[model samples]
Target: MRKSLAVLVSGYALAGLAHAMAPAAPEPDAPRTAPQAYAGLGVGLVDYSGGGSKASPKLFGGYEFTNKLALEAGGIDFKKGYGLYIAVKPTVPLTEKLSVYGKVGVAKSRREILPIAALPAAPLVRKNDTGAYGAFGLQYSITPNTVVTAEYERFGKKKESGAKEDVWTLALKFFF
Candidate 1:
């Protein structure tokens, strides 16, 4: 019984010494949720329901009001067309370095149907249109100020062909 008691006391003392010698934990830096402005560029493929696809590039910028919300505006290049959009962006954090975000709002597009070589006359094309826009994406934070993302965006119906425009892209975003 005396031996067991001595051993128990020694263990407790050793544990206490180890705890006292351990380094203190540092406080974490400020949260990324603070309001910030950001910009991004993406390259992707655009597919149209009417029957064509092309490589597309997009440019965008926005202000994040919080970790969960932001406002963004951007432009995209499509096959024989182009689009500009403004959206409300909402985010869901999945982990310390990963998140899913969505964009919903309005879009303006201009498109044309090129005339065939054998065609006698060129078809008139619409210069501008206003419509709905949407998108969803996943982003992995590479640093507090940078993230890499993959997204799919849809610029709603085309009035000229009654088709939809969809884009899939990989992007890099920077926060300031």
Candidate 2:
């Protein structure tokens, strides 16, 4: 009887230890919409790859209308030129801290070209063009409200041999 009592106590202790080591179930319905709307401004090199690079200051704002659809706007250079785009992104959460998305949108560029003094009699020309833009980027969310992203964008526009202007840009972005 003494031996049996000792075995039973040891079994109970071991069972309690097993129960304590089990992982707790995560809470359900914890909210996941924090990455929805993001707004930020970034000052970076705006490379017109084929044209010329400039010190570009841009304002960016995005609203995630749904998990897959978003509308984003960027205004740059004292609003001399602005881009408004609506895109559908395939977003996949790679980890708790990072995500990847790809988007395709249509963009328009409008700019005022100052008349050169050499051609003082030349009329001022304000050029406007419309094109499509596609972007692919990786985003890191340090916190729910802070994010940094690097994107490669291709803006498709072409100018004739003697055409007035050609504009395309690639940039990196940061959002808070």
Best by lDDT: 1
Per-residue lDDT for 53-140 in model 2, tens only?
5655656777776544566766555233444455556666778767778877776656555566699889766667688767777776
- Collision count for each candidate, in order: 0, 0
Write down the TM-score of every candidate. 0.74, 0.59
Overall lDDT per candidate, in order of appearance: 0.82, 0.58
* Worst 10-residue lDDT window, candidate 1: 25-34
Q: Which runs in model 1 stand beyond 4 Å of their true positions?
A: 1-31, 48-52, 116-120, 158-164
lDDT of 2 at 72: 76
Q: What is the lDDT of residue 131 in candidate 2?
A: 80
CA deviation > 4 Å runs, candidate 2: 1-31, 48-51, 65-69, 78-80, 114-120, 159-176
Please, what are the lDDT tens digits per residue for candidate 1 over residues 1-176? 99999999999999999999999743343348669999999887776545676677889999999978999999887756788999999999998889999999999988765556588597855556788999999998887888899999888674555224677889899998
